[model samples]
Target chain A: MKYLEDIGSYFLMLRRTFSGFTKADVLRELIFKEINDLVMSSLGIVSFIGFFVGGVITLQTALNLTDPIIPKELIAYATRQSIILEFAPTFISIIMAGKVGSFITSSIGSMRVTEQIDALEVMGINSLNYLVFPKVIALLTYPFLIAIAMFLGIFGGLIAGVYGGFISLDEFIRGLQEDFIPFHLVYAFVKTYVFAFILATVPAWHGYYMKGGALEVGKASTKSFVWTSVLIILANYIITQLLLS
Target chain B: MIEVENLKMRFGSEEILKGISTVFEQGKTNLIIGQSGSGKSVMLKCLIGLLKPEAGIISYHNKPTQEMNLNQQRMLREEIGMLFQGGALFDSMTIEENIMFPLRMFSNQSRSEMLLRVNEVLSRVNLDGVNTKFPAEISGGMQKRVSIARAIVNNPKYLFCDEPNSGLDPKTATVIDNLIQRITHENNITTIVVTHDMNSVMEIGERINFLKNGLLVWNGTQEDIFKTKNEDVTDFVYSSNLFKKIRDVQNS
Candidate 1:
């Protein structure tokens, strides 16, 4: 019953958050600015880390496939499978959880501790919609942005792999074409969407309930990152097994 | 008019407010005065619906707050304005944006209309030409004035001020107190101000309710405050050294 109630409340918060997209809403600037700074701008660093991790996986696959039982072409195939199916979405979520989760937690927690949230409520404004909803909507939207990030990350790895002679450009291109199934893309989408929701919601929930002062805000921020990261990795493993198996 | 009936609030094991019932008339500064931890602020919060009273009924005019639906609660909330102790201005927004916020949220006014209303409230608060200033850029007194402007911009029916004179110099405190009284009278709104400052009590205590240990011990006008024979009230009223010296001179 509590879970159902929470979902109902979540939808209400979502409606209010989206309703605030007007040019005049107090949170429009905050939501858009956070999306740009925390999601779009972090793309380069995420792509960099994703690219090398992809390369290392490809190299390892190449070394493993040298036995007579496997074809060298399968090395590129497995690399595509890993990146598209699990690696890109899961790793990028962890990165964003560190970035956006901590940001939401600290910002909202400090607002609560400072009585700014209470002030908003007193002003006949819905503080939860003003504060939490933006970040949650941004979280749901930014994962698709991170999906684009994953594609770019994989593209970077493909370029570096061809340059380093780990695989030919033709083989890399062929591997992506051959191994990229519809379910791989679906898995990527599912993982990222769920991760994004978790990353945004956990921090905001903790932050919203935070008390005391600056020290407690700091603690909420730290706890948000820790709990969100744990939940992401755990959820990643569960979702992958459930979806793929 | 605002009426609170048998309002009670408990925070875990501590009973913060104990059956606070009072009526604040329209167009008067209804002051809640008490020392720290005397539940004055808690009573104010309960009246404003910031804290749910464990037992009691608060009515705006004749509508009981507990019976109002969410939309009704929101409507009642829109009719109310609050000036927080710290001003509570959105730190990220400019003064213009802050003042325009409620209009944009609740009113269907056009951009030009909102801007006009915003400018009118700004001028009313004597905050002309500071529209672009951030909350952080303003002085404490100026922040209080801006908060006043924001509170009144909505043309609220009830104004709740929690410590408008707090953390200000005596001169600034007087200015804020005077501003609140002037705004209250101009709008004919029932203004409920919670404070421990006797200076404010003397300046605008048109109707004063004194709380001690979460009970409304004294309810009277400022004239009644000084003229009363109540020892507790006299001890609290004349305890200041300045008032003591004045008393000595008058007696001599």
Candidate 2:
């Protein structure tokens, strides 16, 4: 019953966050700051993680195709599909659920603890819109990050496949081009957009309504990460079922 | 002036404020003092609209708060300022930015004008030329002053402070108390402070309201406090041995 009530409150918070928007000038400033904090700051980790994970997937695929009947080009095909379909959009979002999600939760949770939200309210500002809406707007840049992740992941796989002698560079390029469907990219981006919204809002709900002191702020951050990751995985299954099936 | 009538607030099954009615006069330092868990802070929160009373009318300048429309409520809030217990300065902003926040949100003034107002308030609080310094870089007392500066930079019609001197030393607390009182007088704003500090109660408590277990047990001036036969007020106010000695010496 408590869990159901919390879920209800979370939706209500989101409703309030979308309405009673802050002034355009203040919102513009907030959105810029959030973009800097949430997206620009996460680029390095995303790129590095994307590259290594892509390389590992390619190596594993090559090793597993031990039968002579299996074409070497299949290694590149597997790497491309894994990186584009799942690794970039889904895995990177989970990583951000840990990194960026915790940041959103802890920062807003601290503000709650310190009464800054109350100050905003006392000043007649919509605290939810002022705090959370900017984050939602700024995360519109999230798919761009996923695009970079896709590029880096495929690039890393190319390096591993060609140089490690798993497949020739020409065959790998051909393999990447073979049976490619543009709809897959569309599906990945659709999933990315949904995950981005979750990434912005779920942590915000946890942080904004959190009570108690510093210890509770830390606890809310952990809970936010857990919930965000759970939702992302769940959403991934749902999206894939709807889009692919 | 701010008037609260028959205010009541509760959390679940436990009632925190039980029918508190009081008036905080303009140009005076109104102190709400009581022991811990006596609903002093709860009353202040209700007055500031941070917490909604289960029953009551909170009026500012003859207008009931509940009757105000959204725009009216925003206008009323714009005319009010608050200094939280921990100063509550935005940690990410510098002193200047913190002071300029409300102004930026409400006023159409240019950046230079906002900066000018911020600096003027900073100077009024006896904190000059520390615009770029963050809240963490300053002392707690200075942070409180910065909060005061922020609270008044918009020239509010009312000011609220929650335990303005809680974490400060004796001397610093007195400085804070004096600063708040002076600012209240200078602006002719209705200022309400929630605290249990006896020093604050005696120094700047022009009008004092004493609460005990969610009820307003006593209300009077500081002079009235020293002479009153009210057992609850005396017990809480003279709880310290030093205050008791002073009271005894005065009686003798």
Candidate closest to the true structure, highest lDDT: 2
Candidate 2 lDDT over B1-252, as tens digits, reads 988899999999999999988898999999998999999888888888888889999999989999999899889999998999999999999999999999999999999999999989999989997999999999999999999999999999999999999889999999899999998988899999999899898789999999999999999999999889999987887889999899789879
The candidate that achieves the highest DockQ relative to the unseen native structure: 2
Q: Score the docking of each candidate (DockQ).
A: 0.50, 0.90
Q: Model 1: what is its DockQ?
A: 0.50
Best by the TM-score measure: 2
Q: So what's the TM-score on candidate 2?
A: 0.99
Candidate no. 1 TM-score: 0.91
| Candidate 2 segments exceeding 4 Å error | none
lDDT of 1 by residue, A1-245 (tens): 97577557656656665553333555677678767755777777777787778777777777667676665567667877877776778777777777778888888887777667887787667787777666666666766666665666567657666777777888777777774678778778888888888887878877887778888988888878888889899998999889988
Per-model C-alpha lDDT, please? Answer: 0.82, 0.93
Clashing pairs in 2: none
- lDDT minimum window of 10 residues, candidate 2 chain B: B230-239
Candidate 2 docking band: high
Tens-digit lDDT track for model 2 on A1-245?
Answer: 99999999999998899988778998999999999999999999999998888889988998889998988889888998998899999999999999999999999999999999999999999999999999999999999999999998989998988889889999899889888999999999999999999999999999998999999999999999999999999999999999999
